[model samples]
Target: MLQKMSSVQPFQFEPEHEISEDENIEDVQYQINQNEDDRKVYEVRVGQNGWCLCGYCLPMLTGKESVCCKELQFFAVAVPDIPCITAHTSFEAVCLNRDVLWAALVSLHDRESADLSYRYASYRQFTWWMHVIRIRNIYSEPDGIYAGFEDVDIDYTEIDQAWRDW
Candidate 1:
């Protein structure tokens, strides 16, 4: 596992005018460069937090917006040793932060729960480490359900673990 993101180098890139075969990918549910014959790509309009919600317009962009969801080139980033992030949007920087990646690979157990989002970078997270991570009050543990907007990340254990792992 990567000890720590040591450095972050954000660069701007767009899907090739004709995307290369290797560039096409399907991971974590987002598809890239499909229908090679069709030149058009899905237009991911910006919602409140800059993530695209599936078609029907959300009256107000409220939902758990995934920063690394393959389709965006925009999002924030946290760099090495330095406790900060920079969003290099427009085609490459998906909601990727150094701490989140570090924790998932180097610290987080395979089953450890976490909620990595741009929200962590917000001012609200200044006191975020005080809370404890717990199953949402809504569900019983081990239900195999993914937590969404249920205040799962209020606890900063995941973040703490990331730094420890680093």
Candidate 2:
């Protein structure tokens, strides 16, 4: 199992922390400067411990990963063409409910090669962790009434679990 898990390549990206808590959704999108044509729509899904679309979340959902199986109370979506979005709540609750959505943009900075350095080690860098990005407005699910991010539930959990699943 360890070997199999190790075989998967983790998605690469950077975090966008420019969003201010007081900023409106439209401003947030403008700050990112992502064009609609370049933007991609990623369906939400449930992974192992929390709802996430990382290497761990993808394999564990298919019974391929078993080391840390736990209740699913989180959500995440990562696409090569768009920013990664995720949300989570406490596992002790009777039902999962998330009120916040965090976004991480793809990395635009990279070094030419890995070179050891005490002060400048090559590493994955994120400007911020779990930064909140506002949603413009509530959008309806495929077969349901209009709903906000906080209202997203099990209905959206299985949309794209097979993405990069091994």
Candidate 3:
């Protein structure tokens, strides 16, 4: 009789320090900002133990036709804070509110580049999504919609015509 070998290893998880319990929200935000400022590239330590299951991993394990493969047990770390917006099986996409996304963009723009940095496409995609969400009022209720920074500007066409005449 031939014996089947299973290569699946025990899942190991490393617990991350909770960021929300800190006394001041500003302090926590500052720490997040500082961490972003100090690092060049963010590392996603998948399958290293304590990291959360990204959208891809979650559905693969729990979906109707779950596979019993060892490779499926591994985890991955992609760009930190850029939610997995791409998994096909997921029912809903994670949406960050406009203010939060804008703040993140502003912070990213203001920070000096570290050795590790997010890919240009990823940053652009997130910013574009945030802009779309702001225009659509995806986060707020019917009467409580928030206006984005761009709404404050006057139309450039009038200025262009005046400058042309001058």
Candidate 4:
């Protein structure tokens, strides 16, 4: 599994933080280009964990990462809670719920990368260790409608037993 995980290094970064406090980054397009890998639509880490999309909340997908697997980068998207989360997932939520996904870019893993560091894609972009995120608004699941980040159940613990099974 370790060998398989290292295979895809899909990510890229910007010289500095691309998301500016003034740019009004309300939404983020997870995939703007073409190809098979661009179709991945990632889900947010709900439950007791909140809207986290990295670390234990994130589960490594099986097979080649043709989409939103760890291969994609998470080096720029910044949340007040998580250090550097994925802007794509975060932005998607923002588009769905105004109080979601819209975060600012803090920094980048590489110094010579582009400004859109928060963008997700298959490349040399910086990936993240903290792959967790909390929801910013009310959410409805098969179980029920959660009020907000504070209201979610966050089913996973430090190591999501369910994610591990996947």
Candidate number with greatest TM-score: 3
What TM-score fits each model? Answer: 0.16, 0.14, 0.19, 0.16
For model 2 the TM-score comes to 0.14
Candidate 2 residue lDDT tens string, 23-94: 999987775675342232111122434443333445243332322222222222222332222222222121
**lDDT-sorted candidate list, best first:** 3, 1, 4, 2
RMSD of each: 18.4, 22.0, 19.8, 22.2
Flag regions of model 1 displaced more than 4 Å. 1-34, 38-98, 106-130, 133-166
How far in Å is the alpha carbon of 14 misplaced in model 1?
Answer: 16
Error in Å for residue 125 of model 2: 49
Q: List ranges where model 3 is wrong by over 4 Å.
A: 1-15, 18-88, 91-110, 114-130, 133-137, 147-166
Whole-model alpha-carbon lDDT for candidate 1: 0.35
Ranking by TM-score: 3, 1, 4, 2
lDDT of each: 0.35, 0.31, 0.40, 0.32
Off by over 4 Å in 4: 1-53, 65-74, 77-81, 84-166
lDDT score of model 2?
A: 0.31
> Regarding lDDT, does 2 or 4 come out ahead?
4
Give the per-residue lDDT of model 3 (tens digit) for 76-127.
3222333443432221211234754565455445324552245544564676
Better of 2 and 3 by lDDT: 3
Compared with the true structure, what per-residue lDDT tens digits does model 1 show for residues 61-80? 32323233333323222322
* Sequence-dependent TM-score of model 1: 0.16
How close to the true structure is residue 82 of candidate 4, measured as C-alpha lDDT?
Answer: 41
